[model samples]
Each structure stands twice: as C-alpha cells, then as structure tokens.
Target: MTSGYGHGLDRDRDPLRRYLSAWIGFSAGGHFSQALSVAIVLYAFSTQSVRALMGWPGSLAVLGTLVVLATLSLVGGRHHIEWHGILPVSLIALFGFMGLSVFWSEYTWATVGGVAYAVGFGALGIYLALGRDLVQVVRAFGDALRILLVVSLSLEVLSGLLIDQPIAFLGIQGNLAEGGPIQGISGTRNYLGFLATLAVITFAVEFLTRSVPRRQAVASGALALTALVFARSPATAIAVIVLIVAGVALNALRRAPESRRSLMQSVFAVIVVLGGALAYAGRSRLLDAVDATNDLSVRSLLWARIRELAAVHDIVGWGFVGQWPTEIFPYSTIIAPSGRPHETGLNAFFDIWLQLGLVGGLLLVVAGTLAFVRSWITASGHPIVAYVWPALVLVLIGVTAVAESFVLFEGTLMTFVAIATIAARKRSWRSRLPQAAGR
Candidate 1:
C-alpha cells in the first residue's frame, strides 16, 4: 500500500533493522548446526579409538554444556529445564536412584563416574529437545548415523586393503580383511549391526514421513541396508524384522478405533509377558531340540552361571557402577569359576537387574514402558513428522532391549535419551501441528 518512494526510503533506512531481523532469526541456532553436534558425537563414538586419543569425549561434553548454558542464559534459567510432563520425572527418578546408589556402591568412585556420564548425556538430550522439534531431532540422528556409516564403510575398506593386521589402537579389527562379518568401524559385529539397524529405521522415517530429498534418502537407506547385510548379525536382522512388524502394526493401530487400540495394547502386553515366561520355562528343552551346543551358542551357559552370581546380590543388585570391577563380587566370581572375568549380563533386563537389582530393574521397565506408551499414544493419529519417527525408533529400541543393552550403553544411550526427551515433550503436539501440517 505504501508508495514507491516510501518503499525506497524504507529499504534505505532499514539496513540495521534488516541485519537485526536476520540475527533474530538465527539466534536460536538453526536445525543443521544442532544436528552437527549430535553427528559429531555419533561419529566420534563410531571412531572412538581416534577420538579417545584426541580427548573428544571430554571436549564434546564441555561443548554441549556450554551450548546448553548459553541457550539457558538467553532464554532464562527457569524456562530452560522445563521438560514435559510426568514421564521425565520417572526417568529422573531412575537416574537419581542410580546416582544415589553410589552411597552404598561397592565401587563408589566408579558409580560416581558412571553417574557423571548419565547426567552429562541426560543434559545433552534436554538441550537437544529444547532446541529442536521432533522432526529435526530425527534428522539430527539420521545425519549422524549417515555420516558414521560412511566412515564405517570407508574404514573397513582401508583396514582390509591398506592394512593387513588388526588396527587395535583404533579398534579396527580388519573385518573386511577376513571373510567373516564386516564389523565396520564399531569393531564388533553386533555393535555395527545395531548401529546400522538404527540408521535404517531413522532414515526410513525421514524418507517416508519427512521431506528429505528422494535421492539422498534412498542412498542413505541403501547404505544402511548394505551395512546390515554385510554385518551379518542375527540380532541386527531380528531388530530390522521387528521394525517392519512394528511399523505395520503401528499403521494399523493408527487406523483402528480408540477402543480397539486400547484393547490391542493390553492384549499385546499380555502376550509378550506370557511368551517370555514360556520361552524361559522351556529354554533347556528348546535348546536340546534345536541341537544347540553345550553353551547354547555361548549364551545359555553364561546366563545360567550369571544367575548364581546374581543371587549373591540379587535383592538390591551390585550397585550402579560403569563396569563390574573385575576384582569385585560378580565379576570376580566368574573368574574363579570359569577362569575368566564376566562383564555384562548379555541380556538388557538381566544387565539392569545385575546392576540395579529387581527393584531398580522393575523401575526401569516401568519407566521405559510408560514412556513408550506415552509416546505412542501422544503421537497417534498425528502427522508423520510428529509421530512416526519417534514411535518407530522406540519400537526398535524396545524390541532390541530384550537382547541388547543399548538403553544403558554409551554409544546408543544418547539416542535413547533423545527419544525419551522428545516423547516427554507432550505440549509440542498442539503447538507444532500447524507448522507440521504446513510442512
């Protein structure tokens, strides 16, 4: 409506105002920069051998802390930690309980150290959630996993063709040098497999629900699938299958009536519990029937022996330290019995029970299950960008929890934290719907 002369005057007079406008738009640190920090941490862990030497872990923690603090400074302290509803409380209780266990911990300093990592990672998740939307969070992880996969593939090639021997210093195991499963840069077949599975699902969500470029998403998905096939891990394969089933089930559940959805959830829970009980009760017969080895592929025997060890501290657990000290009770027990030290329980629930006892383990189960249900329900019937990414990833995580310790382990713990944080952000549904629909 303004005259041409007035428009020219406006442009001429608003130079500093234009700069301020751009600065205001950018003051929040746009999506990709936030994604970059996450990607760096992810890639750092995948190539931890090099990162350890460079002290990247400490540096990342400091950097994340500074970013979080700076953001808080800009947006007032009280508003900074304002996490979503009751879900975070349960998680905080779980972590706080773990931290408090240090008082009774056999290895006090070790618990202190583990607690430090938990707190640091938890804070990072808060920062990530506070800064970005659910869709952005998914992209951050997708970008991180994409870069890490490329690094993994490249390192494997380098290790096989350029170096004949194991690069133990960098944790490169010359996986491609041999004909066995390609461990990628993760150094272990299972670890690489797990990471690849995560990548597959993350990229899948981005491709299906978000507006990622078709070529890029397709290429990323292919890379993840290639890694999955090359890694040749049964656990990873199982996780992928579960993701498929979950995605289909979730799609159907989304379409079903609310009453049916509620009933279906209950039925699913009952079946899972009953199925687990039946599997455990008949494991020996099942093993024999399958012509399994004496060790049942080296897991059953370990599990059986670990149970006896667990009974020693079965009530309250051995306390939440980073690792079972080889010289301590549980770890030391196996050294005498089997002539080797034991590290983990091999099963996620068992591992938690081993560290935090039945009480803590039960608490973790409740927290995780409630969080999963909350995320699923809140995200239900919402657009893809709102629900599909998190709901699917939670499915992968929940299913894998049966066999793997990704929930508590270092490399994937942040992934879990980010999921939990996003799931906790319930208010985002209403606030983000319009913006999401526009996308």
Candidate 2:
C-alpha cells in the first residue's frame, strides 16, 4: 500500500485528485488532437513544391499517443477496453468510410489523410467521453478556449480595423455592407456570427459553474458577447442567447412546485414549438436580426451543390478535403486569383456531407449529438455544470452543422467529446464506489 509520494502507505486517496489528473490528461489529449488536425490540414494541401511540411514535434506527438496506447494496452491488457456511450457511432463514422475509400478516392495519399483525420477525431472523442471527468475538464478547457477565441477574435478585429488587407488576412473579401470590425477565423459576417454565438455560450456556461462574484461573471460575459458581436458574427451569439433562454426557462420549471412544474414545462414546450415555427418562417429576418443573414442565404446553395456532388460519388467521396474545391464551386461565384473557387458555405454539416457522403455524415452527427446529450444528462443534477457546458457544446455543434463540418476536425470536436466523456466517467465511478463498498 505504499503511496508513491509519501512515507505513509495507507493514506486514503482523494477522488478529486484522481478526477483532476484524468481530466488534465484528457484536455492535453485534445490539444494534441488540435495540433495534429492542423498538421494534417496543412500537410494535405502542402505540395512537395511549396514545401509546407510538418515538423519533428508534431511527428513525436503522434508517435507519443501511439506509444501511450501501446504501453497502456501492454500493462492493462487489451480486454480491459471499454467502449462507453456513443463511441460505436463515432467508430462507424470514421471506419465506415473504408468501404467507399477502397474504390472512389482517386488519390491514395489524400484518402490516407482523410482517414487519419477521422481516426484522430474519433479516437480523441471516444477516449474523452468513455475514459475521462470530462465535465470539469471541459469547464477548465473553456478557460483556454476563451483565451484562444479572444486572441483569434482580436486578431480578426485588428485585420479588419487597423489594417488595409481585409481580404487576404481577414477573409472579408466582399463588400462590408454591415458596419463594425471584420469577423476573423471563419471570416464573413455569418462565420464570425456563429463563432461569436459559441463564445457567448461557452462564457455563459463557465460563468454559471464558476464560484466567482456575480458581477465579475456578468462583466466577463458582457465583454465576451461584445467582442464576439463586434466581429459581426451573429450565429454563435444567437445560438448562445437561444440556449440561455431555453436553459433558464427549463430551470424555472424545475424549481417550481411539483404541481406547477408540469404546467410550466408544457407551456415552455409550446413556446419552443411556436418559436421554431417563427424561426423557420422568418429565417431570413432572424438571421438578419442576429446579423447572421449570410448564413441563412448561403446554406441553401451549399446544400444543393454538396448533394449533387455526393450523388456522383454516393459511396465514399471525391477524396476528403480535395472535394471541397470541386464541390463548393456551384455554391461560389467568387473565384480566387489562383483559379480556386471561393464559396463560404459556413456549414459544418455540408462540409462533412461533401467529404464523407450520407452514411458517414449521419453517423458522425449522431455521435456528436450524443456527446453533448450525454454530458447534459450526466450533469443534470449539477445544473450549473451540466446545463451550461452541454448547452454550449450544443450551440457550437448547431452552428458548425450549418457552417462547417467539424465531425472529424480532430482539434475542436475531439477535445469537446473527450472532456464530455471524462465528466460522464467520473459520475459512473462515484455511483459505483458505494455499491462496491457495500458488496
């Protein structure tokens, strides 16, 4: 019973420490995933002529993850593997492409890169969800996420505000009809809008779970919301606002007396249905209202184009990221000077649909949806933690579904799923501990 750190062999361990270590490890895994995803993306487009190559650090990181898995398997034995919750769905999404990949993909290298991306994202998501206290880990990760957003948003703002090269740097190539700083990251009013919505959602959830002063939370939330909006990105902000209202409405009903709770819930449900109807009816206005009109308008064009492309290659795809240029052409009117087409579809769903086809897209969507839903359900009792994080994740997923296909984007989605899995695992451990003691 010798404790590794101390002389006392019998000191009882703190569950919190175990939870934190696992959580941190899971978070680091996500960072690694992001770095890897970036490497893959950069490498995919990198021609031997241009010389955009991945360095030794990235190679070592990938090698390390493999080493860790190999060592873990060797020591713990492979049979100890546990595929918890929605992992199977992700596996199907990633590996199922193999069937189509065998025939359709023109270039073997591109196909390999595509598979690598899927495997990376799938592995990270499954590991986080099934193995890690992903809830707290996610909350902690939010801190870093916010900082990144702030930096990204700020960089975008400067490009739009202080600099003259708006098109190349900021990606706001078209006329800036709407006022304010240009949106960065995804670019365009709608792209920035969705990113902003995610920021607000993340901030709100973290704010609620935090033990910080109410004023501080409010100030921080307001600042984030402002910065997000300043980029003229409405999609992310709108999603956050909608989720907040939904969550608040749900909370109100839960705290109500048992008799009134049902009635309130029913009323809330009706409101949601009515709201949905209104949103659909005034989708344009709603988009404009949130300064996200571009998203609403462009999605239709992108969907049509992607569907047509998929029809041609119904099984696999045009070879992962390569399909983007060809498939996106129908939706895009603007051509780059380099002869590449530029269409800002701004929908993650379409991105996947074009890359993986119908079957893969469906499975990945289910898996991603389940990632948030599981977190939401597990954190139900801890309302502050459960509601916000899952809600934030949902908001991000929703926005991405419309604008970008992040299903196999190893960096962001993988990190999120990993944190979520960690949270769920912790809950399971706690529930079983007492039962095991009794036995």
Q: Provide the RMSD of all predictions against the true structure, rounded to 1 decimal.
A: 8.9, 9.5
Q: Which residue pairs does candidate 1 place in steric collision?
A: none
Who wins the TM-score comparison? 1
- RMSD to native, candidate 2: 9.5
Question: What's the TM-score of each model vs. the native?
Answer: 0.78, 0.65
Question: Residue by residue across 151-224, what tens digits does model 2's lDDT show?
Answer: 55555555555663454533544323345655444444544554455556655655666634567557657756
What's the lDDT for residue 226 in model 2? 65
Candidate 1 segments exceeding 4 Å error: 1-27, 31-37, 40-47, 50-52, 55-87, 177-179, 256-260, 263-296, 325-329, 332-340, 427-439
Residue 176 lDDT, candidate 1, scale 0-100: 73
What's the CA error at residue 271 for candidate 2, in Å? 4.4
Model 2, position 255: C-alpha lDDT score: 62
lDDT of 2: 0.51
* Native RMSD of candidate 1 (Å): 8.9
